[model samples]
Each structure stands twice: as C-alpha cells, then as structure tokens.
Target: MSSSSEEDLLFAVALLANEEEEKRERKVWVHNIYEKRETYGEFHHLFPDLLKDRSKFFHYFRMSQEKFYELLNLVKPCVERENTTFRRAVPCEERLAVCLRFLATGNSFRTLAFSYRLGETSVRRIVYDVCDAVWTKLVPIFMPQPDKEIWERNELEFRERWNFPNCVGAMDGKHVVFDKPANSGSLFYNYKKSFSIVLLALVDANYKFVMVDVGALGKNSDGGIFSNSIFGRKLQQNKLDFPPDKILPGTNELMPHVIVADEAFPLQRNLMRPYPGDESKRNTEKRIYNYRHSRARNTCEDSFGILSKKFRIYQRKMQVSPEHMTKFVLATCVLHNFLREDHPNLLAELIEEATPALQDLRGTGGTYTGSALRIRDRFKDYFSSHAGSVEWQERMINVGRRNTNE
Candidate 1:
C-alpha cells in the first residue's frame, strides 16, 4: 500500500514537473533512465536536486498529502515498541497508503518501490508484514462468531421477508479467474476453460460477508468445495454451537436455523437444498424451492462483487505466486469485512455504483411471470405426496410458510 501510494504521488509529481515545473524552469530534466531510455523526464529545464526534494514539489503539487495521511492512520496500527527495526524503517502513513494502493490497484511491487522511494525488497516486506499484522489483528474483531442475538435478528428478518427460519447466513461458491502458473496447464483450469480458484462464502441477511474459504481448486463444484471445507465439516458433524432446539423469538413453531445453499450442495436433514429428481413434479418443486433459496443465497454474489470492484486488485491479473495470491485473497476478504463493519455507508455506496451495467445484466430470474406460480403448485403436490413422511413434510411446511411470508 505504501509503495503503491508513492507510485501515484510520483505520477502526480511527474505530471506537475512536466506541466507546471517546466513552464517556470528553462532547462529540461530526466528523472530516471531504464531500458536505455529516460522514463521520467521534463520538457523544460529543472535541476535534479530541486525535484529530489519532495517538499519543494509538494509546495505546488495538487495531491492531498493530509487526506492520504488521514486515510493511512485509520489503517495503521500503533507500534508497540519504539525501537523495532520494522517500525524505524518505514513511516506508518506511507506504508498504509502503499498497501491501500496495492489493493486499490494491482500494481507490481517494483513499480510501487520506485514510487515510494523504498527498496524493492522493503516494499515486498512491508506489504507482507502489514497484511499479516492486519489479518491477525482485525479478522477476529471483524469476523467473530455470529452471536445468538445476531442470529435471532436474522431469523426474524428472513421469516418476515423470505419465509425462511433460522437462516443465519446464505452460503454459495463462485469461481475467480487467475493467471495459470508455469507447467501446470489444465490442473487449475475450470469447466469454464479458465484458470481460476473457487470462493465459498456465507453472508448474512444484510449482505455482509460472514465467512469465506478460498484456495479451492476450480474443478471442484460448489457442493464438493463446501462438503470438504472446515465449515462444512463442522456443520455436518453438528460441531458448531447452536441454540436450544426450541422455538425462537416471535415465532410459535420451532425455528429451523441453517445456512441456505443452492442445488449444487447435498440436501441433508439439517442442510436445506432444493428437492432432487428429474420428474416434472419434482422439477417444479425444486424450482419453487430455488426461488426462495436464491432470495437469501444471492448475498454471496453481492459480497464478492463489492469486494472485487472496491479493491480493484481482483479486477486485474494478479502477478504474484499462487501462495501469495491465496494470502492476498484472504487478506482482501478480511479487510473488506472490516470496512463493511466500520464504514458501512461508504461501502454500500461503492457497491451500489461499482457494478457495471453489462455485469448486472447476467443474474436475474426471468420476470415475476406465471412460472413461479406453477412451481408453487408443484410444491403443494410434493408436500401432499410426502405427507406420511413427517421429516419431509416438516421441511416442506417450512418452505410453504417461507413462500407465503415472502
């Protein structure tokens, strides 16, 4: 972040040196030579010493150092020690801005180092160390276990809006494209014929990301990824802490709390997925279940889109190694969770406007046409046929109630 910010400042300064600085000075200046060509040059003459001093440039440069510093302080941690080598080596504000720029734009470390006035190795170390410190310090604070109160509030909202109960979060998976690593041709390639990684996430009713699992091979389907994930395993074994198996707040019947997922996941007694079968009756029932299930599950899409669009790192082709890419991804997600919690209104505005029109056109259910009604009827028939099976009927009843409420 520090390096990246410096790069921006350098660009801004370079622009000023060319336009404003050259107009006053009579001599031309070349900032640096690379590949036998002068990279940073001014049209008119300005002494190298004058441009070397940043204060002189800042005297007339349009960039806001204070705003950059203010943003950096919010992201910086107070160093515990007064004399650590890392602390003494870099300025807090500069490093924070560099990291922010890294996330804000997926620029290379070399480019960042030049702009930040730091060694290439230093830039790499700062980014890694700061990212590590942040992940360790902030992930728990921002992404803690969902408390009973939070779950209850979500349940009420789901019941009121989607006819679902005890739905703590909506879970889903999507593929994020990545550059293929050397000699690993088709292994990382997905069904889409693109090199990618799968992102599994769970989000709350408010569309805030609650949990994320990345680094899964893209060949793994959503169900396969979820089934093998730690969260999925915990859910399967009932290892996650849960409330008493009793009715929840403002409801008469026992509230059924679970994560909502798509048909790609397996339907367990505890995990709710759409009914399976190719029969027309079953298909219709599945469609109706999907309609309701999507209402909640779509939050994952919103979360991913917002993170990718806001950070901009995900927008570009990440040039780091696979391991660093994973770290970058996790770090980005954790940071997003923090910003969403700490600066929600700003995040909301960014998300609302970030998605381009073409991207928004892809994910929409045809219209509120008669197809939904047909599925509703099929749902009724399925419930009637499975009347003798108490468990199936109960699940169906929950779906029925959710549909009506929604």
Candidate 2:
C-alpha cells in the first residue's frame, strides 16, 4: 500500500469526473434566435431588418445604457435571494427576457418560460421584479404627468375637430376573460357568461394608453367598474389637473376639459356621455353623440388592438390569477407607451389613416352626445331607470352646451 498507488487511484477518479463534465458540456445546446415567431416578436416582426444590426435596434429603440443601468440597479436590490433552490441561478438576461416576453407577447408566464427557457415559478418572480423596476423607474419617465399646457391643447384640439372641448383623453373598459374560480359561481361571470377582469383605461390622441385600472370583476358594468376606480374618485373630487377656463374651439362654451367615456359611466360634470332613450328621434340624437364620442373613445380600442397585436398573448387565453392580471395590464400599457415614444414614426405609419369625413358632420371626426351622463346615471342607479323624457334630454344637451360654454 504505497503512496504512489493511493495517488494513482485519486488521479483516476478526478479524470473520470472531468470526462463526465466535458460530455455534459458537449451535449448542451444554446442556439441564438435572431428572428422570433409570428407572435410575441416585436424586435423581429415589426422591424425585421433591424435584427441584422441588433446593437443598433437596442441603441435606437431601447432606453439609454445609463438609464438601463439605473433600472438594473433598481432591480438588483429586489433580487432577494443569494442562493436559489432551482438548479441554475436566474441570470439578468433571463429575467429581462420574461419582461420582454410579457411586453412583446402578453403571454402567460407559464407559456413564456416554456418557450424562453426557465421554470414557470422563476418566470413569475422575474416578471414581477422587472415590473417593479419598470413601474418605479421607466413608467414615470415615459408617462410624465400631463401638464396644463398639454391638457389645454388637447381640449382645444378636441373642440376644433370633434366639437368636444377640453377633452384630455377617452375612457373605456375592456374585458379579459379567465377560468372561473371554484365555487365563485356567477359572481365573476359577466353578460358574456365568462369569468373576467375588466380593464379600464384612458388613452390619448396619440393612441398611447396613459392611465389604467385593472382587476374589477367581469360581472361589473363598465360604469360600476369606473365608479370603484381611483380615477373615478379623482374626477369626482376635481383632483385631476384639467385646463382651466377655455373657450370651446368652434363655440363660445368654456369649461375645464374632461374625459369622454361611454354610456356605461355616471355623469360627473367632467365626464361626458350620450343622451339616453329609445324613441326614433331621441335614438338619432344619441347615435350622433355616440358617433362623435366613439371617434375619441375609439382610441381606447385602438390601444387595445395594438397591444393584442404586439403581444399576441391576449389573443390566447390568459393563465395568471385575476390579481396578477393587474400587473400584466399595467406593464403592457407601459410597454405600449414606451414603443409609441421610442418609435413614433413607425407607429404613425402603421396606424390606419383617418377615414373619409362622416356625412353632414363634415369631418366632425366621429360622434358625441349626452349619452355619457345617462350611462353615468344608469350606473349610479345600478342600471335601472326609465328613459328620460325627450324634453329632459334636450335640457341635458342644453346644460352640456352651457357646461361646455362656461
């Protein structure tokens, strides 16, 4: 039992371990994909040519390196664990991939992880951490609070083009359906008979989603949805910083600008809706209002459309719980705004051009009416109420006119 014999045995064991490690390394495959699948392929689909110069795309479209590093600094503090139970430690690129996947495809974390190389649990954690970073840093930077001048200009533009003065943005609600929780019954079900969360949003002229509130039960009416929202309260208390004392572009009306929603909201002096009724005459008036309001309100749909188109995840079913959907919606909105800001010219060209002018309206844009106030009332009354008399409807139009004038 000499020393040489013992050393020889130890060396043989070490050599075997080295050979095994080399075999494992040889078996591992890591292929870099420059182009992406049809869905969730922002960098690839929208700007395929840029993939050849990936660095240029990052340089042109992504945030500046300093800002990105700042974002990294914010996220580093939230990583939380030094050692993870998972076999491989999650890298920054992987975490970023989750964020990008959410933005690019709006896919569920489970689906994203399967395609992007990570566990579902890790994907969830990484998405939330990156969201925390973007929500704290990038969101505020990209979505700066609208100033008085911007609001005033928005109102002026609305007045001149749409006959709705002092309108900063349009409000709308969209439903995101999901599987009903056990024993939840009809509670989460909507008119569509599906479990869902309604996403309420305010989008601007540029088709940028500026504000959003998510996680309202699907059963809730759009008005019911908005009433419980923080944005709704802000309007009630006049907390929103609206442009003050402005003349409606074509008319003499003067008032602080407001947000235009559908007939599903309660009438706040600042919120506009169409006239409510069924008589052929009254219906015509309501239609006219809805038409104009739709012109403005349609931006919300456009915002949703662009989001779904880019993320494709929305086209498929969502897999996250109702609560996490909030984060998903918020993150998507931020991403939409980011793309709009970073690639304005591209988006501008991609957006459909304005259609031919409506008849009699003569380029009045789309539609408008007192129907919003009616929706507001219906929502406030929980959707019960006989249609107001035609005379009363006329009076509201008058009041609306006066409100616009004042």
Candidate 3:
C-alpha cells in the first residue's frame, strides 16, 4: 500500500479507539447513591418519623397524614409504575410525597433530588406526573359544576356570612408568576413587570373555589380574561344554572342572585361591582353600597390569600413552564378545597398583610344594558335602606372616608 493509504487506515483505527474510550467514560445509569434510595431517602428515613407527629406531618406536607393517604389513594392508580428487572419503580407514595414537598416549600428540583435520593430528572418527572394525577382525580370531586340547588346554597351562605343579600359567589383573578418562555415576547408580561399566568376564579362564601379558568396570559386584563373564559361565557349567557330571581330579603323588589366582584369586572345584570367615581364616594347611599360590596368581594381576596399562604409555591416566582405552572396552580386549588373541609377555620388564622391599593382596571368601552344599570341601582337602593343595610356599614364607610382623607 502507498504511504497515504496506510495513514488513512491508521487514522480510522485511532478514531475508533477514541470512541471506545468515550463510551467507557460515559455514565450508563444512575449513580449508586440513587440506587440506595430506600435506605437513604428522606421518604424512607424521615417520613416514618414524621408520621408519628401529626402536627409535624401537617407542617411538612401542608396536609394532615390522614388527608395525605386519602389523596394518595385517589392519585395512586395514575402515578403508579410497575417494577422492572432493571430496578423497582418509585412507589406512588414516594412520588406523591416528592410532589407535595416541592409544592409546600417551592424548592428546586436539585434540592429535592438530594433530599429524596433520586435523580434531578426523576424528581422533575415525578412532580409533573403527580400534579397531573392530583388534578385529574380531585377536581371533579371538589369542584363540580354547580346546579340550581348549589347556587341557592351558596347564596344563602353569602347572605348569612357576608350579609350580602342575593349574592352567590365572589369572583376575582390572581396572577401566578413564572419565568417567561423562550421566543414569547410580552405575551406573559403583566403591568407589574413580571411574567405570569392568570388564575381567574369564582369562590363561594366559605372560601371554596367553585369555578376556575386558568392559563390565561398575564398581559390580559381581568375583565378581558373573564369575558373570554368559559365561566364568563356561561354567566353571560345565563347558562350557569343560577337560581331564579327572588325578592330581596327585606324588600319588595325582586333581584337575581349575583356574583360580587371588584371594579376590574364589567357590570352585568347578574354581576355586581362597586359604583365608580368621586360621586360614589360623596353620595351616602353609593358609599354604603360600595362598602357592603367591598365586604362581600373580600371573600375572593381572602381565598387567594389563604391559598398562597398555605401552598407557598405562589410566594416565589416559579421556574417551570407556563403549562406545568398551570397544572401546579390547579392542583393547589384542588388541594385547597379538599383541605378546607378538615380545616374550616384555616383562613381565620392567617392575617393577610395589606397590599398597596392598585387602580381598578376599568371595563372596556362597551355600553352597559339599561337592565344592568337598573339592577345595580336597585342593589344600591336596597343596601342603603334599613331592609338591606348592615349595622356597621355606615361606620365602615365613614372609616374608609376618613382613611382616604388622611
């Protein structure tokens, strides 16, 4: 052979040798530390001890041990994986524990992997899978579509607890902040200068989320988001199965069962918002009406506050994709409703810090129907009259004015 041919052969042999060396250096499986997960993992080593202390278990997982097992049973079938000859699959219990711990603390996947003695990639997959399972299994049970009876029950609760006559639920939107996605500019950016997704919810008097519309872009206004949501569409079309109009509790005038919202929502026949402008502040009846409206609408704020306080995932900007973040928020909301049954007074314990008041987002320039305007005026008159007035409403309005003047 010629010298050039011999050199070509030699180069081929050297290239093969380098490839063999690279293959030998590469990791073909997980590290030995992960294989010893049962002996070293927090789920195995620490969770048993946690079960012995109910309070500690609750604090660790943000749910009681009993509730944890109940949730585990519901989600186990979906998250469970069969063992293979290569290795045993991570138990459904451990998968759920990892997911809950991540949500409770909002820790990074790396941090959780170390605690669970699993691969970081494994932790990420487990969290996503388990969150999907939780939402699928629990949403229907905890947040069923309301019927006429359900609407009336909610209305009664609102009247008794909030003293807002003919009210069914309180509606609002919360922004769930997350890292902006690649190749998407200003799509998820909000006025707050953060990238987020909107969680628009209608909450009942007892702080349960009755209906939710998640995964809306953060840049959208609350009114716009509501107008485009399924819940909003149903409400606008009178297909929500709300109860028939009834007489105001102490007045002869008939009124529809309504959802109370802040000024960020449009005024509709069945939706009540505070009257606008300096005139509303100066008019005694409008001031009283606004005060009572605010008192009832606060249930929605308190529900969001309790949810954020308990889950804590919402306290920090999440690092997951918007799709996964939506799953996380929905799962947390399901858990919130589930846990509310066992912890009825949970919201009473947390003191939500006062946030600086934001300018209310006005409704779009669409004209309001005369019927909507009349319904609002009827509520306004009812709230100012002795039949609909609460004893402290006048005092509350006065205090609000005093604060504004100061």
Candidate 4:
C-alpha cells in the first residue's frame, strides 16, 4: 500500500480510539438504593441540628457530637484536603465521618459508599487513611504511656477502686476474628474455627487500654502470645516503666508492682496469675487468693466485654488482612478510651461472646520462677490479713464451699 493509504488508516484508528475513550468516560450509570441509606449523608452533613436528637446522633456516628467534633478537629490537619481546579476536595468533616461510620458499623466499603455518596474505592482509601491517622495522632493521647508516675497512679487506682493491691493493670488477649486470606494456610485460623489476629492488651482499672501488642496469630495461646509479645518481652526484660518495690498492704516487706491476669500469662514477679484449681493444693487460703485475683483479673475481662459491645465490628469476622485488622483494633481501642470518658459504666454488654474456656485461667506455658511464686504468696497473705480483706471476703470464701456442697 502507498504511504498516504497507511497515514489515512492510522488517522482513522486514532479518531476511533479517542471516541471510545470519551464514550467510556462520559457514560453515566445509576442505581436504585431504595432509600435505605438516606440518613447516610443527611445527618452527617447537618450536624448540630441533628445533635439535638441524641439517639439518632449516636446511632449513626457511634459517638456524641462533641466527641465527633473533637476527633474531627484532631485529625483535620491530616485528613483535610486542599481543593484543586479539577474538582472540589472532600471536606475534613466528611472524610472523618466516612471513617467513623465504617468503624462504628463495620459495613463494607460498597455498603458505605452509598451512605457517604462516594465510590467504593474512595470509601476504602478514606477508611484506611482515617484509621491510620487516628492511631498515629490519638494513640499517644489515649494510650497510657506508663512510667514511674503513671505506674504509681495505676497501682493506686487498682487498689482503691478494684480493691486489689499493688496491681498496675489487668492484661488479657483477644482474638479479633477475620476471614482467612487467600493463599494463606491455617496460620491465622484458631480453634474457634475462624481466622483471626490476636490483640494482647493491658487494660487499666478504669477500662482504658494502657498498652497493646497486636498482630499475633490467632492460633497462639494467650500465654504464648504474651511471651512472644512486645509488651510481654519488655515486662520480662524489666525494661518497662514498672514502679519500684512497694510495701505490701499489711506487711513491711516490699513487693514489685504487678499486673493481674488469668492463667494464660506466665507468672512473673511483675505479673500475677490465679492458682491452678486442679493442682495439689485446693486449700481455703489458696481459694481465697484465687478469689481476690479473679476480682482484679475481671477488669481485663470487663474491658474486652465493653470493647466488643461498643465496637460491634469486633463481634463479626473482618475481610481485611491481619495487618489492617490490627490497625482497626488499635483505632477502636483508642476510641473506646475516648468515649469511656463520657460513657464510663464499662457497659459490659458482650460478655457472652467468649466462652469461659476461652477466658479460662490457664497458667502461662512458661516455667514459674521462685520470685514469681513468692509474689503470689505475698498477695495471698495480704488478702487473708485484716488490712487487705474486704467485708465480703469471708462470705465469699464460704459461698464457694456452699456452691461445692450444692
């Protein structure tokens, strides 16, 4: 063919290609949402007026107006965008609102896309960015940065409020359930028949999470997770901000400030666990010690209960990766502490989610050191003494025998 014939063919092809590209770009598709998601944009866009109705306000945002505004302001610098000539940028308020709704409801990006009036892809980026920002900006504020002063304060709160002496925090492990990832084995799968990532946390007396070591395999036992965790390793190496030795409530002998947990954590001088009921000793004193330890340990249990209830997403399995799920857990925990300021009852609504066996007081797989055993003895002695005994202690001891008799 001649050069002119080839040029004509190439020109025609270029014009057709441009026409196809424009047609694809200009095509408009619409869906019928059936009005279910109407509240998605309206209440979020029209705030203070909607804030007057507390139930409606909280039902959507999962946080009060004041708290939402406070968070919006805190994350505004990171999430807010500058408008360009191309199209107007998404406002900071809307960006944060999109994330809050995602965390609050655990709805899919597609489901929230309709509610927030954005593409599913946009919603995905917004959710991830806001979660990252919240964890980065707010973690330092909400998470307890323990030191000498903070540790002492925690001990005081645990003693005065929970009636367990010299306790710093209640530590526990929770499996944040998620779907098995493609191309992965049983690595993330647990005995519960679901894939999950573990969140090993130390919760203070006030139901606030003090420290968290997340992203452990769900199949790992709590003791295993703790021993392998950053917080656990630090505690073992004596590198954390644990307070110096303090005198026992009734004795002149000084003991290390410690965290109370069930048998799932290894017993360290700085960490206390309950006595194994099946072992050699089932004596009344040991029983009393177990009772007192359970009292302190319940703080962690109650913390998880409140956490799961407040963030209903935790109750269901997530579709994200283990890494992203860790972010979600940390973000929820930060919000949990922030919201607890206003709704401080701990509102233990989802206590029934985990079984007693899952929450069991199994001793950590680590060998018990002599000093750790001594700490347990010291606490046991204190609980039996007049200085540490609550008015209900004796009755609680008797009630145990009564249950056995029945």
Best by TM-score: 3
Q: What is the lDDT of residue 222 in candidate 2?
A: 58
lDDT of 3 by residue, 262-306 (tens): 877888989888888687966999888887888889998888877
State which candidate, 2 or 4, has the greater TM-score.
4
Give candidate 1's TM-score. 0.63
Q: Write the per-residue lDDT of candidate 1 for residues 1-406, one digit (tens) a residue.
A: 6999999999998998788766655333323442122233221123244346544322222113443344345456642224453224455645655566676667788887666555577668777766666666667776676667766776667656555555677776766666787777676677767666766777777666677877777666555677789878887787766555445344344434667765566554345554433543445444555555666677766777777766666766666666667777777777776555544454455556455210111121111224434433433343334321123434653576678889
Residue 276 local lDDT, model 4:
83
Give the Å error, residue 145, model 2.
4.7
Ranking by lDDT: 3, 4, 2, 1
Tell me the number of clashing residue pairs for each predicted model.
12, 26, 0, 2
Using all chains and alpha carbons, the TM-scores for the candidates as numbered come to 0.63, 0.63, 0.89, 0.89
Model 1 residue 231 CA deviation (Å) reads 0.7
Residue-wise C-alpha lDDT for candidate 4, range 348-389, written one tens digit per residue: 222333333223223445678998998898888888788878
Compared with the true structure, all predictions reach lDDT values of 0.58, 0.59, 0.85, 0.77
Top candidate on lDDT is 3
Decide which is better by TM-score, 1 or 4.
4
| Backbone clashes, candidate 4 | 2
Query: Which sections of candidate 2 miss by over 4 Å?
Result: 1-89, 106-111, 144-150, 157-163, 182-185, 276-290, 344-406
